[model samples]
Target: MPENMPGRINPEHITIVLNQPRYPENIGSGARAMRNMGFYNLIVVDPENFDLEKVEKLSTHAARDVVEKIQIFDNLQKALSPFNYVVGTTARLGGQRQVNSPSVMAEKLIPISKENNIAIVFGREDRGLSNEDIRLCHGLVNIPTADFSSLNLAQAVMVICYELFNAGTKKKHDFNPRLASCYELNGMYKDLKDVLIKISYINPENPDYWMNYIRKFFTRMNLRAREVGIIRGLIRQVNWYGQKMYKDGLDHKKNQEADL
Candidate 1:
């Protein structure tokens, strides 16, 4: 591992996350690809088959260290809780799935990685990340392919890891400040959603649909921890004022009935 230079990426800050992977072989190969690219942190969320022997066999000796250090979580949000920035990988794009190419994602990540922990999330083999999974991501990356868009899980992992490795060696000095971790951002979103619903700013029946636009808007800002706290505080104040006004209206209605 090289020292963290001004324009170089620190591989230690980057994590490879596999979400709901079906096969042990793909997990092993994904670890191997991370090792090839000088990345070591690997997290598996809700894997279907996690056979250690098979995983080690496919990963081989070269990546045994990576295999040994793999962290398994029952869900994606908990697995990604510690990361400050998350870039999701998906072949399908439309609706809110605005994606950047691997190289572009790599470029964007390099600067962010300097001051934040990053997770490059790859979804399942059959279907990529679900809409809910995509909501957790700060950004998205799509590997360009021919007409046959489907890629083997390991192959997709390797492609993304390769780009990050390649980008790390280049000299592009763009400084991005530290951003809030997924945990803090998710907390802020939860509170914001509740407040929005209380004010009828978003439809209570389907708040997530409206919240998606808010998510993108805030994601673009790359809010820091303090900024998130500030937003949450504002939300609390709004909630308080709304309740106070509602109480006052009820009191006025009761007094008018008494006068009658």
Candidate 2:
């Protein structure tokens, strides 16, 4: 940990999202945990008959403001729309999911939170994140346990928040980079896919197969806004040139027809 960067990220920049939380007590305690670690923003998505009184009671005055100001959303995607970097927490994980421990994630998150809105999403009490829900997130976080891996909703929240707070308190470098937002990245990828399709670089029937690979490639780069803009510009140029060549070939064909 370097010492140059102090107070790099504010608590306001980080949001804790509980998706379809079954118990108000859990939500309350989760808020309490966040408050303990200096985080305020809380978003509840499709909660199950949550009781404000229960929340307030369990929060124990620590997170009264958080409980009162909690944002509610019907859809997970809409709930996460405002955030540029979204990380989903999961107990069971496999496949293409890249799950990082809380400590590792905390280090990566600190710098990004300084420049963009960050959301750390916790799933339901019964089951963890669905495949669809996980897909929306930019990354995954997993809390390691001994034999019994399953953790209570609030407990999981506390572990991750604690790591983030601990990481923030430590010495850090002045690593403020102008990274592209998720919205901008999505737009750039769309344009890239279009250009790739136009040039027959990717199969039209399953462009996402190639696009997912490309997305993974870019995610590692932590691409800056200017880098994304340059890539988009390059795609546009390629598309323009491809269109020109096609039009020129058509003109040549018409000329041959006229000569004959």
For each candidate, what TM-score against the reference? Answer: 0.94, 0.84
Tens-place lDDT digits, model 2, residues 38-118: 888999999996899998988888788888889999989788765778899998867887899999898888778777788
Give me the displacement of residue 205 in model 1, in angstroms: 1.2
Tell me the whole-model lDDT of each prediction, alpha carbons only.
0.91, 0.86
lDDT, residue 227, model 2: 92
lDDT: worst 10-residue window of model 2: 1-10
lDDT of 1 by residue, 1-260 (tens): 23364355679999999999999999999999889989999999999999999999999999999999999999999999989999999888887578999988887787788889999999999998988999999999999999899899999999999989887544546568889999999999999999999998999999998999999999999999999999999999999999999999999999999999
The weakest ten consecutive residues by lDDT in model 1 span: 1-10
lDDT of prediction 1 = 0.91
Q: Which clashing pairs does model 1 show? A: none
Shift in Å, residue 148, candidate 1: 2.0
Error of 2 at 49 (Å): 4.1
lDDT agreement of model 2 with the native:
0.86
